[model samples]
Target: MSLSLVHSRALLGLEARPVCVEVHLANGLPSFTLVGLAETEVKEARERVRSAIQNTGLEFPANKRITVNLAPADLPKDSGRFDLPIALGILAASGQLDARKLAGYEFAGELSLGGDLRPVRGALAMSLALAHLANDGAMPRDKPGMPARQPKLVLPEGSAQEAALVPDAEIYRAHHLLDVVRQFLPGDTPPEVLDGWTRIAPIPRREQADYPDLADVKGQAAARRALEIAAAGGHSVLMMGAPGSGKSMLAQRFAGLLPAMTTEEALESAAVASLGGRFALENWAVRPTCAPHHTASAVALVGGGSPPRPGEISLAHRGVLFLDELPEFPRAALEALREPLESGTITISRAAQRAEFPARFQLVAAMNPCPCGYLGSSLRACRCSPDQVSRYQGKLSGPLLDRIDLHVEVGALAADELVNTPPGEASASIRGRVVQARERAIARQGSTNQALEGQAIDAQCQLDDAAAKFLNTAATRLGWSGRSIHRCLKVARTIADLAGAATVQVTHVAEAVQYRRALKAAH
Candidate 1:
């Protein structure tokens, strides 16, 4: 019997666990078997691997007993990512390729019956995993930087480019199974330069990201200011308004007001996107805005599957998650968001496995005031009864509302007002002030104000005597929870930062209080 092994990765959420594809050939009755894969996947994988070798004019031990096993059987594997590894293992076991040459390389790519290579999902996650593993131990060198010890990652053309996004990663792109076979064929053969096989260069981060101009919205200064405060502090927002009040427009453009993404943030966001098969090279450093429809299920919002993939919230990490017509979303789906909002991470536990994904997204939710969509509108009279309005507004739970840092009312614009009003402030000017405020908060506590907790909250957001009295009195009368009090204090700290103030003042407290009152009737 002859045996060979090839290395690959299996994706579980953002994590990529190492997988070994073992192929063995023995003289016996003609048979082929695959183990460690779901029964549903075995047939397809076997056929693809077999046909790929035969079609590429490579030797296949069809007359002998062939066995293929993916080690670590408990790890759930999905997609065709292992096809290339399995095929290479078969060749090595059949004595068609040198197994020793496969060292220092990890492979992942789907294969066609014709031996053409297909792109695999989560390429960036795999690359990031390899990069992290290379730095797992040992101290840093004193004189020069530690030499990069990452394994060379081999993938299909499109996927290779995605994997190359990781800094200092060695990635090789192959267009066909033959291209890979040529490189690993018996000893000392020179690697020929072919158009089908090449190294992918990591694209540099974009200098600027494009978003819809905030200047289009006209004459809603209060709502605009609330958005500014939310952006400055990385706080969640709830916007209640009548239809066509620019709530949706404002929510869509909100991502532009926050600080630009750092290299680490961009890589993390891209990694999540890559897992979902939604990443694009053009969007390398651009902040994402994930706007799932109201009909989306809890699994779609927070992520759940047999192996547990990342959901919409995770896809929006380091960016915005805009939910328009918030009340229309299922109550269960809406409730699922409460935990990730506080923790900045969502863990999906399944019977088979558990996966956690980063969910540090700025939520921008908009909703109508009532069932008729204009409860307090001057433009049109609301036709829904008071009970109908109450129930509609009550769709949002109190706990969810309390977690939101700012609640602003966006009023409908009159025709004359729409025509007469000039363009509002540009996103660039607002983003500059937001960035300055964020820098101040980071300088003070090394994090965004919204992330403050326990002693950090009190230490970073210290309230003056008058400000403390005002907040205490308001909390008591409003019957707020400790969480609500803390959230308000964080907002107040952000307001103080925006004004370049050394301490929280009564004026900052008062502004924060007005935001919490926007949904008083609904509460």
Candidate 2:
């Protein structure tokens, strides 16, 4: 056989698009060439593949003109993930292995000069893409008439295990190029001791995941309540406080107040982590908490690159994104969050292509009340002038503030008060109420209160006559925008859920109103 084809995948955002490696050896001046929109990293695979094959005692087509093309020329190909496939294709084309045996199997891995296979990124994403294709009747058939068998994924040990996490996925782990060669060699007999290759099974972690307990923080009842409400409704929160008021501590423990993840949620979260090359078996089924520093660029907060990758918010999908010292973040970065916060997704558009990443993360942000951190504090005087305070608070635009549903004040606890205060309620107890409230919201509307839209909000949050009048008067007096009023109603609906009330009452409306005014500058 003078021509051979091998299959692989390329990471484009979360979707793993297919790529075909075609190798041809013909009589001409000895040369090596790789084409089809390959980046420098991929073009370098030619050297790695050649070295690996030669080092493994295989015949390299040194005297023949060799050319490799990653088909579908428009798709941008990067990384050394195609190295293994290119090597296999070359060997098969040069008559060293059985080219026909490569059918029904896909390969992805980087190769060392010693022929050792190195893991690639987006293994789980590729596996999930295969599953999606199969379910959607789009998985390509190896041959038109043969009975279909599940596609086998050949990857490095690390990536093989990650791919096996997908249900019903067939994964084979190969430690070296020689291991893969032995499988597809031109023979029906199996190797006597194929120690380097084995099938991997999905290993779902059985143990319960643990997080920081909310009981560690004391004497911030209002802030704790707000965290519970935010967790229940999937609402973003802003905490304003003087220094040493435990805003960060509360935010850190906020994830523990949410319900446990479903299997679907866990798989989606782990798949995203795998795409970012940050997936770990221990972190499986555990909700993530991403806390990027205030100095992070807007591109880092939201995803953007030559080939788009997930940012902090997407990595925190189905989890929490805590931005401590919120006002200290770059204005551009802060503003970039507005769209994703509302839409639960982010679309990054480059000149050549556009990619969308899921970013349905709960936001927990905290900031000092003033530039001096003691504007309304009874313990210490604020040193900044009014203009300084105004400017510092003005860094967060009104539109951005409007997106945050809960704004709570966290006051500093006196020494005596801190010493005398008992351990506050544990997260387990608070999470019980939160989970129940969340269930009520999901049962009634099929989503969290925060996700309710135009007509859905008006239908689910049917305010009684008294509650309607109170909210109307408050909206008019406070000069609230339609968006703000809707947000307040969502919070009220959450409060009603917590109390197990049938409708949003005046008491619920009043409590929800308090949360909207904790930061005076937000007005």
Candidate 3:
């Protein structure tokens, strides 16, 4: 065969688009030609593939004219993930291996000069894309009358493990180029020993998620309660406090109180992490806590680039995004969080490509009460002027603040008070209550309270007469907007769930109202 075709995937944001590696060898002036809208990283794969084939003791078509085309030539291709497929296609076209055997299989891996197959990013995402397409019945058919063949993924060792995490995925792990070559040697005979080549099953980790303990934080019961309510309802929270009031500590331990991730949630979260090249087998099924620095830009939070990679918010999908020193972050960056906080997804549009990433992450943001971080503190006089305090609190827009379901104040503890304060309730105890409340909400409405909207919110968060009157009075007095009232209702609904109540009560409404003081001192 002088022409060979191989299947692979290209990542544009979270979606893994299909790409074809077509290799054609013809008699002409000896040369290597690569064509497609390929990026520099992909063009560099030519040398890597040639070196790998030669080092693996395979014949390289150096004397013959070789042309490799990554088709649909318009799709922009980056990364060395196409290296293995391009190498395989060249060999198959040059009559070194059976081209027919390459059907029904997808290959993606970076090759080292020593013929070793290195792991590539987005392996799990590619596997997930295959599953979605197959289950959605969109896979292309091999013959006119035949149904589409089940796709099998060929990846390097580390990447194979990640791909195997996808359920029922036919994943094969190849350690070296020679191992892959042995599989398609143009014969019906099987190799005596498939040493580096392996087929992995669904590798679901049974290990429990580990997080920073809530007991590490002391003397902030109100703040702790806010965290619990936020976790139970899947609501976003904003915590304002003086410096060293344990706001960051509480935020760090907040993930421990949320319910464990379901397999689907884990896969979505891990898939995004894998796209960011930050995934690990040990971190599987564990909720992520992404704490980007205050200096991070809007692009860093919302995700942007030529290929449009996922940012901190997407990486924190089904998990927590703790923004400490929230006011110190750029206003644009803070504003970028508003859409995802409501829609649970973020869409990034580049010049050539548009992609959306799941960003259903719990936001636990913390900020100082004032510029000096001690507004209304009993421990120290607030050094900043009233104007300074107003400007600092003004950093967060009303829309963004309204999107946050709970706002709580964490008071600074004096020296003697801190010394006398014992360890707070253990995270396991808080998590038990949180998980129960979450289950109750899910059982009642099929989703967390924060996800409820429109008629769903009114239906799920039904309030008693007294609670309704109280909430209305509070909102009227505070001049709350419609969004704020709805968020408060959701928070009250979560409080009711925690109390094992059938409906929101006056007490729940009152507690939820207290959490509405965005910056009580400034107000």
lDDT of 1 by residue, 247-307 (tens): 9899989999988899889999999999888999999989999999999999999998876
- What are the per-residue Cα lDDT tens digits for candidate 3 across 1-523? 9999999999888878899999999999998899999999999998999999999899999989999999889888999999999999999999999998888799999999988999999999999999988777788877776755569999999999999998888999999999998988898887547879989988857756899999988888899999999989999988988889898889888888988889899999999999999999999999999999999999999999988899999999999999999989999999999899999999998779898999999999998888888888888988898888888888889999989988888888889888988999999999999999989989988999999999998998889899999999999999899999999999999999999999899999999999998575455
For candidate 2, what's the RMSD? 1.8
Query: Residue-pair clashes per candidate, as listed?
Result: 0, 0, 0
Per-residue lDDT of candidate 2, residues 387-504 (tens digit): 8888999899999999999999999999999999999999999999999999999999999999999999999999999999999999998889999999999999999999999899
Every model's TM-score: 0.97, 0.97, 0.97
Total clashes, candidate 1? 0
- Once fitted onto the true fold, the runs of candidate 3 whose alpha carbons sit more than 4 angstroms away are 138-149
**Which parts of model 1 have CA positions greater than 4 angstroms off?**
138-148, 521-523
Off by over 4 Å in 2: 140-149, 191-193, 521-523
* Residue 326 in candidate 1, Cα distance off native in Å: 1.0
| Whole-model lDDT, model 2 | 0.91
RMSD of every prediction: 2.2, 1.8, 1.8
Query: How much is 24 displaced in model 2, in angstroms?
Result: 1.0
Ten contiguous residues with the weakest lDDT in model 2: 141-150
